[model samples]
Target: MTAINLAKDGLWKNNPALVQLLGLCPLLATSNSFATSLGLGLTTLAVLTLSNFTISLVRGLLDEETRLPVQILVIATFVTLADLSLQYWFFDMHQRIGLFVALIVTNCTLLGRAEAFASKNPIISSTFDGLMMGTGFLLVLLLMGTIREVAGNGTLFTNLHLLTGTPDMSIQLADSGFLLLALPPGAFLTLGCLIACKNVIDGALR
Candidate 1:
């Protein structure tokens, strides 16, 4: 297969979050705000890319027996780096996300690739897989974040200070936010609607 096929598989056809439904715990739990989702999504991207690279490098040395443990170790290492970086740089966002940020190490998408794709693939391919898969994950996170933020708070990018802006504040939306969208039930309902919409669009294209 060509590079394009790999891209298609990772980005749209076989995304960890949207297609395979992996890593829903963090996906659903922390996507109430655009900042939170973007922060987590980027961190997950870094972990997935780094873990994929490391796993591909060691694929030849390990057997199936030792690979899973080794893969987790690799993922954990990068996740720690991501976690500390967030703590040091974006301390507030780190505090807001709490343990969920560190838990990206345990996310199945990272391990799934280790066992399913990265373990057998070359480094270059594994890297591409990680990047595209992470992009897919980030895309879903951003979509959910947009819906949640707009619906919950009637704003798109409210808390810019967490990254690089003023503290204790945000640009308020002119209209009243839908309080229901901020709730847990709202997340489930919105996600279900998103999936249904995607399916309908796919069906229409077909």
Candidate 2:
């Protein structure tokens, strides 16, 4: 597929979070707040892109049996780097979602892309695909986090300083917000609404 098609598929047509639902564990867990969501999203993006590029570069050397293991090793290496970097640079943020960072190795989105796209494609195409797919996942996390934060906390960007190293950037929207949205049940409800909206939009476009 062309670059444009790849971008479209990753960002919308086949979003890892929204459509493929590949990494919902981290997506839902870290999406309670915007700062946590962005932190995990960016880390996942970096790991995904780098792992794809690395896997594509070495795809020719691997036989069918060892491919999955090698791809996973590449992904794990990147995830470790990301986790350590976050711990060193953004200790507070890392403390919030560091486990999730490590769990990126198990995220199906990374492995699926490595197996389905990167292994079969050229380096440039594979890298771009990873970047786009990661961005799509990040956007979905951001949206989910934004909705949950606003509805549950009555604020946006609460605890954002953990990621930005700046003063608190939260903007309070109300005196109080819905308590349910701050809980696990809220994640499911919000995701359901988002999927429904995407389907409606797609249907309209068609």
Candidate 3:
């Protein structure tokens, strides 16, 4: 694919969260706050990029029969590295999102890219695909987290110290906020609205 088309696919047309709807578990569970979303998003991004590049390098040795298990082994290796690195450098953030980090190995988004794109393409293209796809996923997480935090908590980036380790970094907008938006039902509602808005925009453009 052309670079522009690849970018469009990742950012809009075939987004992992909105279009493909892969990886919604962590997308909803940890997206209640901006910091958590950003943290997990970056972690996923790193894993995807590395896994895709590595898979592309070894694609020749992989056949249809061995592809699935080999892909998971490659992805799991990177996920473990990401998990350990986070714990060492960003212990607090690790503590908060560690479970989700471990879960990235099971995330179809990563494995799908490895099997569908990385295994069929050159290293450079696979790496770019991983980056773009990861960025799309990150954008959705950030948007959902922002909406939920702003509407539910009347703040943005609350408890951000968990990620940045800086004091007084959160922006407080109001004393009180809607409680429902902070819960699971609220995530579903926010995601539904987002999908609707995306569809409306796409339809208008078309």
Candidate 4:
């Protein structure tokens, strides 16, 4: 596929979180607040890009029987590095979503891209694909976080300083808001609405 097509597919047509429905565990768990969502999103993005590049670099050298195992090891290495970097640099954020950070290894989105795209594509293309896919996932997490945080807590970016070391950027919209949107069931409902919206938009385009 051309670069444009790859970008389009990853960002919109085949988004891992919104469309492909991969990595829902972390996506739903960490998307309760913008700060937490941003933390996990960036970590996942870094690990995805690095692992994809490394896997593509060694694709030709890997045996068919060992490819999956090698890919897991590469992903694990990056996850470990990402985990350490977060703990050292963003200890507060790490404490909030540290468990999910380690769970990036189990995210099928990373492994699926490694096996299906990285293994067959050139390093540059694989890296680009990873970036696009990771960005797509990040965008979804951000949207969900924004929706839930605003609707549930009546605040946006409360504690965003945890991620961006800035003065508090939060804006309180109300004293309080819907309690359901801040909970787990709210995640499912919001995601379903997002999917429906995407489908409607796609249909209109078609």
Evaluate residue 194 in candidate 1 and report its C-alpha lDDT on the 0 to 100 scale. 76
Q: Please give the lDDT score for candidate 3.
A: 0.92
Candidate 2 ranges with C-alpha deviation above 4 Å: none
lDDT of 2 by residue, 169-202 (tens): 9899998899798798999889989999999999
Better of 1 and 3 by lDDT: 3
Candidate 3 clash pair list? none
Per-residue lDDT value at 114 in model 1: 80
Q: Quote model 3's TM-score.
A: 0.97
How do the candidates rank by TM-score, highest first?
4, 2, 3, 1
- TM-score of every candidate relative to the true structure: 0.93, 0.98, 0.97, 0.98
Model 2, residue 110: distance off in Å is 0.3
lDDT of 1 by residue, 1-206 (tens): 46798788877778787778898888888788888888899889888988999999989999868888888989988988888898889988888886898889778999998889889999999998888899889988889988888888887776657876566445567476887887788788778887778778778989
Clashes of 2: 0
Cα RMSD (angstroms) for every candidate in the order listed? 1.7, 0.7, 1.0, 0.7
Off by over 4 Å in 1: 165-170
Query: Candidate 2: lDDT over CA atoms?
Result: 0.94
Sort the candidates on lDDT, descending order.
4, 2, 3, 1
Task: Please give the RMSD of candidate 3 to the true structure.
Answer: 1.0
